[model samples]
Target: MFGVTILGNNSAIPTLDRYPTAQIVTCNDQLLLIDCGEGTQLQIAKYRIKRGKLRYIFISHLHGDHYFGLIGLLNTLNLMGRVDPLSIYAPPELEQIIQIQMECSGTALRYEINFVPLMPGYTGVILEDKDLSVSCFPTQHRISCFGFSVELRKKKRKLIPDQAKAYEVPAAYYGKLQEGADYLRKDGLLVKNDWVTIPPEKGKRYVYCADTIYDVNLLPYLQDADVIYHETTYLHELEGRAAERFHSTSVQAASLAAAAHAKRLLIGHFSSMYTELDPFLEQTRPIFPNTDIAEEGVTFLV
Candidate 1:
């Protein structure tokens, strides 16, 4: 299963009901944390997310709202006897920030933390496994920031059972055939893997646009994404204010998703001033019919 669970959706100033930016991308049993805001660990527990499966953490920027809870989470994981090494993808400055906090507190982690720096203006694949791939690209924000693109893909080709049976390929060798291996029988028959299988469909993509102002340059990454998550920190009436803060309005986010032809649009990073979220949907739905509020604890399957 490939899905994103919203942990915290509010912007910098967290409200009573909403929190700062944080999300969990679940790919099968593995979990990737997109951002760690204040009280993220508590939210994780509230949502019943499996902390043991969390393998990677991606911080969009150095903003306190995005990563202030990181050290606390690390401490809790260590106390809970977590031994697996974790990887963090973030700006280079975060490495020092984490180190300084750990140093001052005399806290030495039992597990190793592999830090992969996402330098300014850098964009490329950061992590790839058999079932998932992740990449990061720059986003226009108040500071140096990045947006992540997560793709869930199958490594094996699609298997055609009828063709395999007609070729006299044993059922036991179906797995190997799907792995693109040809087979030779004792009767001197060569069965090409392509004869029984075809290439798998393109991977499903979920692009998180992080914190950014209205920028058309992001269309390449958002193009035809299964789901695109963009920040709508303000309503359409406050477009000028959003631009001043380097944030996007509800309409702007929907417009980009419509232009990119994204299948679904998830808008969050809402301002704390507004209590009700319906207005945001009301503003975006007309521009892009398929839009959803990034409600806390709700999982959006890709």
Candidate 2:
């Protein structure tokens, strides 16, 4: 149930076939919007994503391609009579920006909006809920951009059904057993939680590199990530151009994934200049074999 669904994968421009940068990170029942590029709400509808599950919105930077659709999405949620509180994490300026829009339009939202400002060069855990934790780190982009790392925590322990049954533990109480609670028998004997269950396996991690130039310092945030979404705005031939724009090339993205030892790499944020996407994979696979294009509407399991 933990995965990322791409809403928009293109950079800057919204092409007829592709869109700007946006993604939905699904952590169990909760959904987090990673970016709200133009056409994001339509893409969410087009993909039939459960908008009601969206609890948080994260903006990497003020770049139009990264957050232009945020206001529209928020307004739509209000029009739909959504009363659930929504939390937004982004740069400090975004709060004022959203406030200005709401004031100018004389719009009052039906739901509560919590704005958490991310200061420049900030690197730390931003959110921790019952099911997931999210951390943000700085990225080398044209503006003050950030990359996010999401870890879906394993809360329940692994239960040994045979052992539990042998201990005369009722099946109805297995849920509590998996939660590390000791079982009390009818005869007053206590069965240790560890006797029937083991600690849960380590959690899986998904890292989103957002928009960045080739920088090795990012390895700390990406190390041992189960999946990483890194922007490949250009092919290897356009590496110079990518650097000039503070965007990354295919080869550079692959190199970062390889350096981080990520299990898989998802590359997107492609420049509109390239009509076809095969070259990106072709160039990346040699450097990191476990690389795939972050195609819109595709859900990548973390």
Candidate 3:
């Protein structure tokens, strides 16, 4: 089960009903947090999500709306006596900021915390564990921002039941066949692995374009993604303003999705000036019919 759950979707300011940017990506048994905006812990509780299951956190940039809640969340976790080690992947400056904050408060966390710094203007794979892989790429934000791509790989080969039975392969050997192992019969005949299994299916990918202007350079990272989350900070009417702020409009997000042929597009990071969200879908759907608003507390299956 690979999917992303939106916790906070608002842009800069936080309204009574809306929040800043934050999301949780569930890859099989592991949980990875994309951004930790303010009040993220409350949002987690609101959704009944298992916060303890979280193992990794990725911060896109130094924007306050993107990571203001990180320290608060860490404090709460330490207070709750969490002993499991946690790792955070973020820009190099974030480590010093976090360390200074912890130092001033004289707070010593019980669990080990590992900080992996992402250099400015750098884009490449950062982590790969089991079937889960995460990579970061540059985004066109005012700061040295990044976008993340999370992919879940299919490592096991597909078992062909008809071929396996035709080869007189025992049911007990099916597991080995899925693992791409040939079977040896008692009579000295060999049952080829290809006769019983096919190659693994393609991986599923979810790309989070944190904050960026309408730029085609992002297409390489977004190509053929199963699900994509792109910020739509304004309507097309404010396209110039969006460009000035280095943000994207709903129409731009839709166009990129159409270009990349992504399975689905999710639009969020809405500006506070807009009270209604229907216009976002109205503009995006005309270009990419599968576009959906990244509503808070909603989970999109990738």
Whole-model Cα lDDT per candidate?
0.95, 0.95, 0.94
lDDT of model number 1: 0.95
Once fitted onto the true fold, the runs of candidate 3 whose alpha carbons sit more than 4 angstroms away are none
> What value does the lDDT take at residue 145 in candidate 3?
93
Q: Which consecutive 10 residues in model 3 have the weakest lDDT in total?
A: 44-53
The best candidate by lDDT is 2
What's the C-alpha lDDT at position 218 in model 2? 97
Q: Write the per-residue lDDT of candidate 3 for residues 1-302, one digit (tens) a residue.
A: 89999999999998888899999999989999999999998898899888888999999999999999999999998998899999999999999998999999999999988999988888999999999999999998999999999999998999989989988999988998888899999899899898789999999999999999999999999999999999999999999999999999999999999999999999999999989999999999989999999999999999
For residues 202-279, could you state the per-residue lDDT of candidate 1 as single tens digits?
889999999999999999999999999999999999999999999999999999999999999999999998899999
- Cα shift from native, residue 191, model 2 (Å): 3.3
Candidate 2 per-residue C-alpha lDDT over 133-231 given as tens digits, one digit per residue, 9 for 90 to 100: 999999999889999999999999999999999999999999999899999998999999999999998999999999999999999999999999999
Between candidates 2 and 3, name the one with more favorable lDDT: 2
Best by TM-score: 1
Poorest 10 consecutive residues of model 1 by lDDT? 177-186
RMSD of 2: 1.8
Query: Candidate 3 — which pairs collide?
Result: none
